[model samples]
Target: MNIITLYHGSGGKGTHELIDNIFYKYFYNKILDQQGDSSIINNINGRIAITTDSYVIEPIFFPGGDIGKLSVCGTVNDLAVVGAIPLYLTAGFIIEEGFDVNDLEKIAISMANAAKKAGVKIIAGDTKVVEKGKGDKIYINTAGIGSLRNDVNLGIANIEVGDKIIVSGTLGDHGTAILCKRQDLNFETEIESDCNALNGLIEEILNSKLKIRFMRDITRGGLATVLNEITNHREQGILLDQNCIPVREEVSGVCEILGVDPLYIANEGRVLVVVASEHSEKVLDIIRNNPLGKEAAVIGEVVKDKYGRVLLQTNIRGTRILDMAEAEIIPRIC
Candidate 1:
């Protein structure tokens, strides 16, 4: 069929055809080829990390990546930040009845390529078709499994005064790109989404055996929400230097025009790292050496005063509270 139909989800002839032509064709692997009710993964050692997320991005396709790529990366990063080695992924698709078959194949191809690059397998998946207008063109849900590192112990409770707050790269690229695309805003330079898998980058730091207090992937709620969430009800507060936070000129300009705070903008590829002061410099050096972390910087520190608060020291040397985002600034942003 040129376009998805309800029959494709009936678990009969049409369903088999759809699975064989697209899902099975692209996501082929030894484990997936078995075609069993569930994938059997063995030889796993140490603690296991599993994360699941649903992607309903407004536009199925975006600047640097699409919803398919976003689904895999989002799930993988969730595991990576928890100090895990990502190994397998399961993707589920919900396509509108009238969705284009070519588009579906493109998305499947993107997912396959992304999984390959992330060194993970798409072991199993499910697909469903809904009535036209009952759903968006497409939506994706993914679950990732990983093995936790025995040497690494990370948590917010480990945060102590004088610990450094490091962001892997500039902020707001992903949110800004989605906004510009949805609003049809034009600019001198293109603002592409920073969506990417961070397992490799995270592994590099974990391999160093540094003293990491905590690590989190910068996603939906952005840095502001993450900082506020971690510092909330805690003995130690976090103080951020406005000038120290890395932000691309293009992103800053976009935020200014749109009257949006970059700190509240979502980032898919960036990571927030908290490490002891002594190991901060070495951690920064290691992050900077990687392509995904070239713009990494120590933006803040845990403080003893202003407990349970996130304070930002502005470029003008004035401090202000950076609270959790109360409302959604942009919708359907992965």
Candidate 2:
């Protein structure tokens, strides 16, 4: 039987055969080929950045991407937002017993394609199979390594009152798309997940020589949570112009129907960038020119306030306070 079984994960002949035939065959690289207890990688001269993430998005397959592609992009974006050039990635897969070998091959191919698109390599990986009922169809974990630019110094310490906040594009697309597909909620327009690698777009911004204070990918708690975190300890507060924020019509509709705030919804491809006010326009222009950032906009700015907070200037010329999500709105959303 070609299906994965307990024997395949038993650390014996079956395990070796599986590694030699499938894993090594697809993710072959000089460093990974060595197959030592740990992978040996060359040290970078400058600062090195490392990040890890796990993907357990329900359904495994979704409208725009699958768990495999998401795993690679998730890690790559994490490294990239910190002003790093992603170099290599290590993947760990957990598959359920009796899973289809053909589906596994498809996922492997998807991971390879995503890594190629992001200009990174999958240098190492591990595979394990669990009992059929003990696991979902599959789960993936990835770790990424990148080299940081010596000239770039980005962090909360750099954030100042007057810095502008820019979001890469529309919000909540990924979360809405996943929710719809998972619940079998049909809409006239099919919403696809905005699952993409943002390293290229971020690279463009970095090349423009803008003074970016900090950058974060809106993932779990969405933009609101990210903004709150950034302003938590600082004396400065964030003032967001609600009208300036970009939200897709379909995504907005889904959120309204489900009573979810787009600001609190997750996004896989969107980025929250804070730059000095003087360089905001140039930064916005650079982001707009990129395919992934065509809808980029300056949504808000940092302000001097007694208490660290996030305030939203409503469209009707009123203001309201926005805070971090008190509870989980959506779960298992990668």
Candidate 3:
């Protein structure tokens, strides 16, 4: 009974006990305590944004966070970047038979703590068990809902020539950390995943009255991919200064050894902010004031071009077209 078994997912006494002792123990709230099939959310009286994501990270536990924290943060960030104030979340778990109960509890605790920090509620969740060898230790899926701020207008359509592009923080930390853990690559400096909830930082920026054009959390496709995506089919291209983009030395070293570019690596907590040049400096100051955005920098800007493209100004005074990643750089990197 110390480990998860098929009976624990059978929706019987065992399943009820699991919910009472684990999920409810930490996530208990007036709304979720109702234990209904669908939790009712009352008094949400504005535009709402919703987003869903699944986490199947190779190592359930990483240096700075685990899959549980990643799941909540990822979903919350998705909603926040869309000019929303994250409010509620729903989680689903697929746990394999023979998984350690202690590990499961730890993950649940992580999720609960992350939810509390993000100031959101876990309104509902589901659990399922898979055959021992049929699944990984665990996989988590989360959906987030947030009330949209009426004052904010964010989209690619609002992007224009002379707009400034800002990145919240260092890139490739999450991807490099996962890669090191998976590949067992040892180095003098340890890389930790920058997995964190960005709702607070994002909300502050949105409330600053800046002309924020667009925002996106840098995830699977990395900064280059996001830039390429935003510039697609636009009249203006994006030009980036190579030196301004923040990349930890250790991360850069690992990318160099692996023959990869950090720009194409994934990040969990990082975001791309596109704002008009007039308000870019104020926006940067606001971002830097937050703990999650201490390393924020204005790395690029929109420029005139017939063909929308993302161009990087190399340190060697050469420019190159930065394209979307053709293939997955690292798989299962949340």
Stretches > 4 Å off in candidate 3: none
- Candidate 1 structure quality by residue, lDDT tens digits, 275-305: 9999999999999999999999999999986
Number of colliding residue pairs in each model: 0, 0, 0
For every candidate in turn, the CA RMSD to the true structure comes to: 1.0, 1.4, 1.0
lDDT of each: 0.92, 0.90, 0.93
Superior by lDDT: candidate 1 or candidate 3: 3
Q: Residue 164 in candidate 3 has what lDDT?
A: 97
Off by over 4 Å in 2: none
Quick one: RMSD of model 3? 1.0
Q: What is the lDDT of candidate 1?
A: 0.92
Report lDDT (Cα) of residue 104, candidate 2: 79
Q: Could you tell me which 10 consecutive residues in candidate 1 have the lowest summed lDDT?
A: 322-331
Tens-digit per-residue lDDT, 1-334, candidate 3: 6999999999999899999999999889988999998898898878889889999998999899999999999999999999999999999999999999999999999999999999999999999999999889999999999999889889999998999999999999999999999989999988999999999999899889889999999999799899888888877899999999999999999999988888998899999999999999999999999999999999999999879989999999999999999865777887
lDDT of 2 by residue, 133-248 (tens): 99988889999999997878889989989999999999999999999998899999988888999999999998888799999999988999999999997799999999999998
